[model samples]
Target: MEKYLPYAVLFLRIALALTILAFVADKMGYLTQAGTAPILWGDWDIYTKQLQAILPFIPGNISEKLAIVATLLEIILALMLLFGVKVRWAAIGTGIYALLVAIVAGYGVGINAILHYSLLVISAASFLLACCPIYKFTLHGIKKRSTYHPY
Candidate 1:
């Protein structure tokens, strides 16, 4: 288990990075149609409407902007995780983002969409665990610092 720790962390990082990159590309209108539409497994319009309904505090334009920001943030977080730079903060941020995605997709949409979100959640969790003190490989593992230290 100890010997494979670094490899495991690398694998999780790669997976999360790829997943987030794909989402960012899709949101940037490079994957499909060129628009500010929300990407959904089913009907985009219906999903957007549901999102608006769920998050009524966000105005229409602001919600679209938020989606784009979220995608960009995911891409950045994924890259940071992959490079093992600020691993602890990046992992925690990604984990929270994954949980939000899971909640929105699972309840707002359908179970099928939840699959990918759940995978993200698991990957984020793995990275988070790898950053923990008990993990065999991490920046923390090398430096042996307390959790309060900002890397």
Candidate 2:
């Protein structure tokens, strides 16, 4: 059981990576389902409407910019996790980002979605995996032993 722990962590890392990527794809329109326009609106376009609906104090353009930046951050974080470049920090950032989204948008949705989307949980999972990276199948793992000597 102890020996397979790395594999388990790797599996969790990959799962979180894929999960984040799926959301990115949805935002990028590679996986938008029909009739979701009423709810999801499919992409960064939802940023304006959602921000306005939840926090009307923010300007429309600022909300749009936030959406774009958030999307980019998600993309970067996903890539880092997928490639195992900086899994720990990426996971932490992912968690923080997801928590913000959960706080702002999670409230407006149904209990099921709030739970299902589970960004906050995703955040925790990613961060946990970061603490014990397998690195057996990752590019970063191959280059050299990670020098992440946290103080």
Candidate 3:
């Protein structure tokens, strides 16, 4: 178990990076649409209609901004996780983001969206596992205190 700790951390970091990188790539039009584009589902007209649908409570403009913010954050979080910087905080943030994605997809897009939500949850779990004390290949590994002690 101790001997393989570094490999485990490396796996987690790479997995999280790949997951988010796929999302970003898809958004940037590198990957073809997997399902119906959320904007075409209704009267919505925007680069990202899923954002508007998921955040009905916010004004359309604000919702668009929020969506952009969320996307940027995810990308940043992915990069941070890949580098193993602040792994504990990144894991917690990833978990919360995954939960939010699940809630939004559940409310706006129905059961089909759950698949994406589940992937996010898995990514979050990976990050959480990487933050464990036994995983010692990360940038945070040098810290004397275990930041992920709660988990």
Per-residue lDDT of model 3, residues 33-145, tens digit only: 44556412222233467677666778977877776787798898888878877776776677677777776777887767767436556656755764576546565555654
Candidate No. with top TM-score? 2
CA lDDT for candidate 3: 0.66
Q: Rate the local accuracy (lDDT) of all candidates.
A: 0.63, 0.71, 0.66
Candidate 3 or 2, higher TM-score: 2
lDDT of 2 by residue, 56-106 (tens): 677887878877787788889988878877777787888878777777666
Give one clash count per candidate, in the order shown: 0, 0, 0
Residue pairs with backbone atoms closer than 3 Å in model 1 (clashes): none
Cα lDDT tens digits, model 1, 1-151, are 7657556666676677677676666544455664434453233444455567767778998877776577578878978866666766777787777777777666665677677446556655645744654332445545674222343
Stretches of model 2 off by over 4 angstroms after superposition: 34-39, 107-112, 145-151
The C-alpha stretches of model 3 lying farther than 4 A from their native spots are 33-47, 123-127, 140-151
Highest lDDT against the true fold, candidate: 2
Model 2 residue 8 distance off true place after TM-score fit, in angstroms: 1.5
Ranking by lDDT: 2, 3, 1
lDDT of 3 at 144: 54
